[model samples]
Structures are given as structure tokens and as C-alpha cells.
Target: MTPDSLSRRQLLTLTGSAAAAAALASLSLTGCSDRYKLRCQHQRTGEVYRELNIEIGSVITHSWIHSIELSRWTDIYRFDGETLMLTSTEFEAYGAGMPLDEGDVSVQDGQVVIENIDREFEAIRWIHSHRVDYRIGVDGDESLIDTDALPDLEPLELRPK
Candidate 1:
């Protein structure tokens, strides 16, 4: 084949290779069980907290997590797996902010716990504070998920935050 013809064939092969690589990249992400979103509520106070969206690929399933946030209310001093993060604005108002004096956030036995409990300012703090963890899954059951679920979403009416 002529030089120009050879170059055209090489270009086509490279294009196909690139397309295959891209497809494989996306497929690998889908195959991994590490990424998903969760909706949870606090068993106590019947308060709700929606964690909007969380990409857990980088977060360990059962590990201590240190977070920094700016807020006047709902100072989330600590959290365990049991402690749920609000998924939306509505639920956030209901779940309430974690107490500040409680101490550092920590994960224990696959659960998250906040030390202090300042019921008096929870509500007000939730609205003002930028950090909070007090929502629970409606069924209180955890599910391995590939897609985000909104139990509080319309139609299903899973839970009223």
C-alpha cells in the first residue's frame, strides 16, 4: 500500500483502540461495588437527614472519618455508621445537627456515634450549621446500591422528613 494509505489505516486503528479503552473504563466503574448513595434517618427524635449524594469509592466502609465544616448550628462533633447524614434540605432541617461538645467524630464497630446531645439547639443548629449526621434509612436497613435512592422523593412518599 502507498504511504498515505498506510497512515490512514493506522489512524483508524488508533481511533478504535481509544473507543474501546473508554468503554472499558466506564464498565470497570460500574462493576465495582464501592460507589453508591444512601438515605438514612436518626432513630431518635424521628428526625430525618438526607446525605444528598456521597461518592464512597474513596471512603472505607468501616473506618474513622474526620471532617471539617463551617456552621453556627448542628455542630457534628462526631458520627458513626449508625448516624446518618442528611440527603436533602428538607430532611436536614428535621434530623438536626450533631452536638459540638460531644467530641471528635469516630466510627466504631461499623457504626458512627456523636458524643454530646444538645437537644435544645439541635433544630436551630441544623439550619445554621453546615455539618450534621442524624438521618436513618426508612426501613433502617442498609442496602448495597449502584444507583442513588430517594425514598423521600415524590410518588413513593418513602418518608416525610
Candidate 2:
């Protein structure tokens, strides 16, 4: 073949390879973005939880107060792969004019067991609380749970300073 024709063919081949590489890189990035949008939901209560931007072996605490004198709740979560373990603590400052408090509000060290994980990133969690058995449903999605809309509960540290 002529030298000019050979050069033209080589250029076309290189250009095609570069385009493929770019498309692959974009797909890889898009996959990561999708993972970041994962969420967890409680089937019974319809309570949805936004996955905190936490790394493995890391713990994050989210607290809210509902008239500190009346009630308050704190949730601590640890994430590992498709599994997320959560420790939820709720406190009632006053009960029927009597001091009645329950549940461990302190940070506990350990891993919570995951019951199930589905193709849609929906996870079923089994929690033993106050001697009662409970199942929590967790699902992933693009939209995150809006804590701002919750009534009577104000996030302790998420507010602007």
C-alpha cells in the first residue's frame, strides 16, 4: 500500500482505540456514582435512611433532639461493602412524671449482622432490641432521605454555624 494510505489507516486505528478507552473510563466512573447513591429503608415504618459517606471500619453518629427534656435519638452506623450495621438509641427524658429510660445510648463496638441482600441493593436486617425481634429493610436509590423534613428532630451537627 502507499505510505500515505498506511498512515491514514494507522491514525484511524489509534483514534478508534482512544474512543473505546474513553467510553470504558466513563462507564467505570458512572458505576461508582451509582454506588454512592445507595440508601436503606425500613419497610414497616417507611423510615428511609440516607447512607452516610463513611468508609469501612469507620463509624458515624447522627443525633437529634426533640425538646431535650422530652426526648432525643441518636443513630450510629458502620458500613462494610453491601452490609451496614446500625446502633439506634432513643431517650425519653420524662415518662408519665416518672424517670423511665431504656436502651443503650452509648457507642457499642461490634458488627451488626446482615440478614439479606438483593440484586436491587435492598438489604434486610435483623435487629434484636429490648428483647424484641425486628426486621429492617434497606434499599439503595439516587435520592437521599431528607432529614430536614422530619418533625421535632433537629440534627445536632448538620446545621450551619
Candidate 3:
């Protein structure tokens, strides 16, 4: 073969090798190329849950309604490079003979905070009512919740199969 042809072949091989190496480097930086399956279940009712299959740098929201009470639950999460962080979650339930409940949970500084309110009838004639509120912070954050911005329960983690 001509020298020129030989030189061109060597250049092509080098270029292909460089491309493959770059791709492998990218895969290594991403840790795992496979998508992870994430799941979070209700704290009270184990039957209610949210599931997602996702990869790093992905955001997902899963919601479902209780089969019997028609209560709703929604969870939003974002997968950072290392962990899946909870952004927000909400649960609301209203039914006969049950207290009207609303709950919210949010993440702040790598910790989770929760606020909830329950309302129920105080008398048989429905002439009186009562409300109870709760605020909780998890993950070593002791800061009190802002009463005005009280928001909504389950924590979720993503795992590789």
C-alpha cells in the first residue's frame, strides 16, 4: 500500500480509539449507566406507594389515590449524583367518619421536614370543630417549622438491582 494510505488508516484507528475511550470515561464518571428503581410507601398504609425507574440527574413525581378512602398522595424526588433527594410530598384524605387530614414534607439542607394538620368534628351535631397541627424535622435539623408555610410523609431511596 502507499505510504499515504497507511498514514490515513493509522489516523482513522487513532480517532476511533479516542472516541471509545471518551465514551468509557463518561460512563465511569456517571458511575452506573443503568437506571435505578426507586420506591416509597405510605407511612400509615403500606398498600399505597410510589415507584419509579430513573437514572442520575433525573426528576420524577409519582402520585396515587387510596383505593378505599380516595385519599391522594404525591411525592417528588430528584436523583443527584450520589443520592435521591426528596423535594416535596403531599397527602390529603377526607372521608366520612374520618378526620380531614392534610400533610406536607419537604427537604432542607439534606434533611426532611414535615407539617400536618388534622381537623375533626367535636360534637355530634357538627356545630363544633377542632384542629391539631404538628411539625417535625428529621435528619438532625432542629429548626422549627414556619407556621405560615406549613407544607405535607414517606422517605424514599433509590437502589440498583
Among all windows of 10 consecutive residues in model 3, the one with the lowest summed lDDT is 121-130
lDDT of 2 by residue, 118-143 (tens): 12212333221322212222233213
Candidate 1 residues 40-132, lDDT tens each? 343334434453233322121211112332221222211122233332111011123543454344555433444334222112122111123
How does model 3 fare in lDDT? 0.39
lDDT: which candidate is best? Answer: 3
RMSD of each: 17.0, 14.9, 18.2
TM agreement with the true structure for every prediction = 0.20, 0.29, 0.29
* Candidates sorted on lDDT, descending: 3, 2, 1
Q: What is the C-alpha lDDT of each candidate?
A: 0.30, 0.36, 0.39
- Residue pairs clashing in model 3 are 103-152, 104-151, 104-152, 105-152
Which residues of candidate 1, in runs, are more than 4 Å off?
1-28, 31-35, 40-53, 57-71, 77-101, 104-161
> What tens digits encode model 3's per-residue C-alpha lDDT throughout 1-161?
32222333454475576764665566557654444543333233333233444466555443445446445444444555455455655555433543233445455544333434322211111111112222223222213322223223232222212
Off by over 4 Å in 2: 1-28, 40-42, 45-60, 66-73, 87-144, 148-161
